[model samples]
Target: MIEQPRHIKSIPAYKPGKSSVDGWDGPVHKLSSNENPYSPLPSVIEAMSHAVATMHRYPNMAAPELTSLLAQRYAVDEHEIAFGGGSVEVAAQLIRAFAGAGDEVMYAWRSFEAYPILVRGAGAEPVQVPLTPKLRHDLPAMLAAITPRTRVIFICTPNNPTGPAVGHDELRDFLTNVPERILVVIDEAYGHFQTDPSAARGIDLFREFVNVAVLHTFSKAYGLAGLRLGYAIAREHIQEGLRKVAMPFAVTDIAQAAGVASLAAEDELMERINVLVAERSRVEIDLAIQGWNVTPSQANFTWLELGDATDAVSAHLNSRGIIARPFSGEGIRVTIGDAAANDAVIAALADAPRPSA
Candidate 1:
């Protein structure tokens, strides 16, 4: 038998959401993935249509135009921006560039499910610090867990699954105590959804700290998940390191055109964000009134602490044609979709009997 690497053997395959099932004729609302329910901005769609005619030629390997637009919008120099397939790919590149077999990569447990997996895949050891009682990253504990082997630390503000974010002051304090050599990755994929004034905006921190790299994605609020566009903003040196590991022409021409156009439609996109934020507040209030333990979410999704009942609740929702992400022993995460989809989820929960008190 051909020998497979031990590391590859131990890694579990990523579980993507199921799209369809036999005999399921009911209307399916997929809230499993935190995707934008609104339509892609008209400007983006028009740009994509125009780019389709030029698909014969290879895309720009450097993504100069897109990077230039991003630099202008984010107020960073063009040399400080690097584009990738998505924020996930950028995460992988960061690991490959800075971390190695003996190096340790630290992040909060249950923040982004892919963090540990990506870290391990890059031949690095993953050190996951447990979240605090309030379901936020225990920065102090994570800082204490760091060793000389530590190379990179991922901080997912407005964190995944459990939806609270670390405050700005807390982040500044944490960075102050962290060693200068360690690279800090602020993965703010959901940053656009955050409405709180105190939430840590990765770009703001990236401007202040030379060691920090901030990753953002068009996959969430921009409603371009299918286009697979994301970018990282960092100091020039860090950006160059990321570029070294990036796959050539990884972002397609259509995606680049779409991204440039979408940036131009920021005002229209913000209107859609306002809608999601309003709906999220409504969902949170309704869930709380119904006696479910809904975490105070600052992102585009809400997490319910269903405990062992997680699987059962998830199955019930699926049966009703509503898909949610069940985090096994952790809990269930439901994305805040359009009003109708949100209503369907709440209605299903209201219909199901509460687990014994």
Candidate 2:
């Protein structure tokens, strides 16, 4: 029998949302993962198809073309950017690079589920600051939670499983107060779906702050989740740390080709995003009409603060063939899927019993 460390054993495993309804043969609308409902653009698929011929060859470990284009796009030096299998992997790299046992990595509770897992994987203590009553990151409270051992802080904007983004003014103020030695990572995996003009842009903040690192993913808005590619932008030293810990050739050639194609087809992709944004608006309005008060979302998903009624409501939605992401006793995070999927969720919730007061 293997003896696992208590720290590793105590870490709660991340449970992903369900993709299918049990024993239901009808059309299933999976709104569990916050994935872009649209298929990859034809150009992207074409690029990936072409790259398929080189499957036998190892990928460009440096990903020079993708890095060069991203550097040009973000106006950062190529050395300041690093790539990984996903933003989550890049985050793991960041944690492994900067933190270890006895160090603390802080993030808001009920944020991205992977935060604690990643922090613990690196043998760092995870300091979870609870969100405000409104389900938003409480910057002041997070500041209060900081300690001398704090090495990394992850701020997820338009935070996962909840929809509100940290405002620019508040974030700037928070960054100003944070010690310059502590690495503050702005996780913007959902940034492309963000609509609020005043929301903090990590890229803009990266230029202003030396300790800041910005995480981006092609998984969400770019519809590249299947290919698994994400990147980070930060100071050269931080980028070097991430690169040092990154898995060799983590971003495959097919994924790199798709990334290149995705950038070239941004205009068309943005048009698709516009459609999803409109659908999000529709879902919010319809949910409100059905007597559910939802937090306004700038990201591609909407959150329902179901409290004790979460399990029941989730079951009810499952009965209707809608598999949305439910966080047990907490709340449900429903992806703003296509019109059909959104309508199914709205209709299912309309029939659900009101959430506990």
**Maximum-lDDT candidate:** 2
Residue 156 shift from truth in candidate 2, angstroms: 0.2
Count of clashing residue pairs in every prediction: 0, 0
Please report the TM-score between candidate 1 and the true structure: 0.97
Q: Give TM per candidate.
A: 0.97, 0.99
Instruction: State the lDDT at 173 in candidate 2.
Output: 96
Pairs with backbone N, CA or C atoms under 3 Å apart (clashes), candidate 2: none
The segments of candidate 1 whose C-alpha lies over 4 angstroms from its true place after superposition are: 353-357
lDDT of 1 by residue, 129-162 (tens): 9999889999999999999999999999899989
Q: Tens digit of lDDT per residue, candidate 2, span 20-71?
A: 7887888999888899999999999999999999999999988889999999
Candidate 1 RMSD to the real structure: 1.2
Clash count for candidate 1 is 0
Location of the lowest summed lDDT over 10 successive residues in candidate 1:
15-24
